[model samples]
Target: MFVTDNFHSLKQKILFFILLSPLLLSAQAFRSYSNEFLTIGVDAAGLGMSKSVVATTNDVNSIYWNPAGLVGIEDYQGSLMHASYFAGIANYNHASFAMPIDKESAVGVSIIRFGVDDILNTTELIDSDGNIDYNRIQLFSSVDYAFNFAYARNLIFKDVKFGVNAKIVRRIIGDFASSYGFGFDAGIQFERNSWKFGLMARDITTTFNSWAINEDEFNKIKDAIPGENQDLPETTEITKPKLQLGVAKSWRIGRMFNLLSEANANMRFTKTNDIFSSDVVSIDPAMGFQLDYDELVFLRAGVGNFQYITEFDNSKSLSMQPNFGVGFKYNGIKIDYALTNIGSVGNALYSNIFSITIDYSFFRP
Candidate 1:
């Protein structure tokens, strides 16, 4: 009798695995977009310009862009942002804090979360009595989280700054599986003759994630489906290194108006849909501009994600993403809003992003 019961339990588990095969394949396989949540970016101000602020970024958001910019913090700064994607089905949130340790060094920490909550679990829909039961259905969530620790210092060379970031990545799949990953990033910024140049290397050491699967939970839904392989899924994921180079300059339009312009090139070793694609490396270029009046009110615009879209008839066309934003600052508090559109031409979704930043120079400690 024990042997017979064990066989039945095994059958159920197989059926469950078959249902979630698509998810398993995407998560376990090596891909260009591994740890893609990190690439989505943070802060309304940055996103408003389509993430083209790497050369000019110098606030709490710099923890994710180019940490070297953190040295721009005078005393202490904190930032928070929230946005919804995919028609409110998924949520992205971020928070960060930065402070200067002395006159030339600074430290910062940031957190990010992207998740899809309250998903239905139907593994237990069928009871042992051979009856269909809706009561057995459960709800669960799949979430990804990242923690960043950063440090920046002024290089001995004049007008140069250097920085690095240590990152911890965590992913959870409704208690059935989880992964932990570690990675590092390095960046440098140099200013000469009113021109700011920056370089950032993400996942410089090649980030890796090791997954742990719950055996007991995995076994609960045995071969509920026939003619399906029940082998355990892959246990490892890898994210290769990427490079970003940027240049920016700022000019005073008048006594009360200032304008800043920036351009960036993102390089990936693997061939991709970017405008410039090659087997050795692919480069995506972006540009943005910001106009501020009396350092209080601001307007921002940017274009990026240049790609060649292939049509049904095998023809290709160029496509790009556009972003817009506005900002207001008063009494050390700044509020920013951005309307960002993603996807190829004729098939795009818009998401609204909001962020707030506070700076306090009163506390020296």
Candidate 2:
């Protein structure tokens, strides 16, 4: 849903047809939650939240965000993210690990958890007692393991890397609801000189095979609609994929400074299916600066199509219209963090990401 460039008059027409071809096929939009509240980028600790810059494999976390980045992983790398939000009522945590399996192969795993506290459980429709029981909370967890099986002697004298992953997801909702699903993701990454480009396609095949509902709640709803078929409205199965494209460039500005710029676009490719509904192809443009001292530090800022979800809002002030983050590097290890404000859907959004990276150098053959 964006515009790029054209080589010639005939090239423009050909490019238009190839890009719009996906609309001819079926589509599914929301692969995750309706809000897609999983933050805009990678771990909050890294500058990725402000930009889509995973093509170069700067760290281990990129494997989960873009498997193609795994081709750049050297030796072993790992990272962890922990964040608090909504006045400390919610928490997000994650850890990712990637290791070189061989000269041209690498594998990685990631675990992420989201928790909401002090959720008042109610029996009747409305709150009868002013003080509801605050004895429990809600929890959501997902674990993804990806193996980067990459091999490329050279493509026309250029290095090319391809990767794919199999992911499993699980969620629990305060004993009231729970669902688990299996999905797959694939990507290609390339890095040459100061330029990096990557493409990632997710949810090629996904199935939320099981959903458990509370027995008492199911009976209540069934009784409310006496003569009707009363099948649960949330039991529909979905199978669709989301494709994203990203590119980045980093320039050595001076002896003690570096400037990096990146751009990304995400879209839902179906035109006729309800699953392909809510198409909002958003582009995130970001700029980052690295202060090269004895210890490396990074500063970044950017903006995108993030507005509001259902839990929190910030429409008053700057309105979550911009994204910002910082990073720190020691030796070969790095850490990143980011924050965004979305105040439209009654929810506030926040994420904290941390990652560690190890570097290995290979002389040009």
Candidate 3:
């Protein structure tokens, strides 16, 4: 009876969180800050499916998407993914390994890095000639990194699983400034036959970043541009919790064909200027479809990031982005590729991602 009561209490908490999330936001101005890299999906498979894998994720990549899905792994697994973001101007990489501790529990660790390389710092002090001396320029880069440790376990209630991720985040801009933060995520998954449901709460404790700046170095480059106001360093940045909910269904079409479809909703409780308007809340909906041929090869497609805009004159517009990918499995190795659409920003941009996964069981001995 105690276990039953706790289960009901958890359910109530989850419902309350979902219902009250939007109301929790205040009518504050939108701002952007560090750890934005966390918004990027890491795996090729999930990116190809427009990140609608919250319910369908069942592999090592689950370390980033939905930790509860880690309970679906049959054994030990490792995966690596790389993407050429923004036409090779930036790089995004992810790696993870997961091992089952018991029949009902698992643990995983993962790392993610996203950054640009060898950017020429044009703000260096001018040379004697004052011809915008190229020799004074130095090479620097901006990078973001996150380390995640996750754990998942099935509950006494059949088909229900819970997971959590504790992560450390660091962001750097050459030697001028850096920020460090710690955050946590929690997730729940439920599976019944071919149907799955998932919910993830990110940054449940409101991630906080403490920034340290090299004021001397920054002052040297301040006002490098004519008539430009210098930027003052920030001491701290805070990110509020976000929520994702998803549902998936699978069907066997015949002896050699199988199909899966999933839908996901992403909600941000924080105010962000990047959205349509100065709304205190934001929501993005995504959908994906996958077809598996004998469980050997898979074709996938998805659409997401539908933003609705309202003009001052009461005009409305909508923007939709789509992504596609394919996957092949041989023996214990699986390879996946995805082409993600970046909308019509600056002459049609797209990202190419490649990922590989190896699955092996340590219990064979």
Who wins the TM-score comparison?
Answer: 1
The true-versus-predicted C-alpha distance at residue 215 of model 3, in Å, is: 0.6
Residue 300's lDDT in candidate 3:
94
In model 1, where is the ten-residue run with the lowest total lDDT? 14-23
Error of 2 at 173 (Å): 1.7
In the order shown, what is each candidate's alpha-carbon RMSD? 4.2, 14.8, 14.4
Output the TM-score of candidate 2: 0.67
- Candidate 1 lDDT over 81-168, as tens digits, reads 9998788887999999999999999999999999889877766765776555789888887888999999999999999999999999
lDDT of each: 0.86, 0.51, 0.78
Clashes of each: 13, 20, 0
Minimum summed lDDT over a 10-residue window in model 2 is located at 19-28
Residue 123 lDDT (model 1): 68
Winner of 1 and 2 under lDDT: 1
Task: List, residue by residue over 70-188, the lDDT tens digit for candidate 3.
Answer: 98898889999988778888888999999888989999999999988896655442444434455766888778899999999999999999999999988777776777888999999
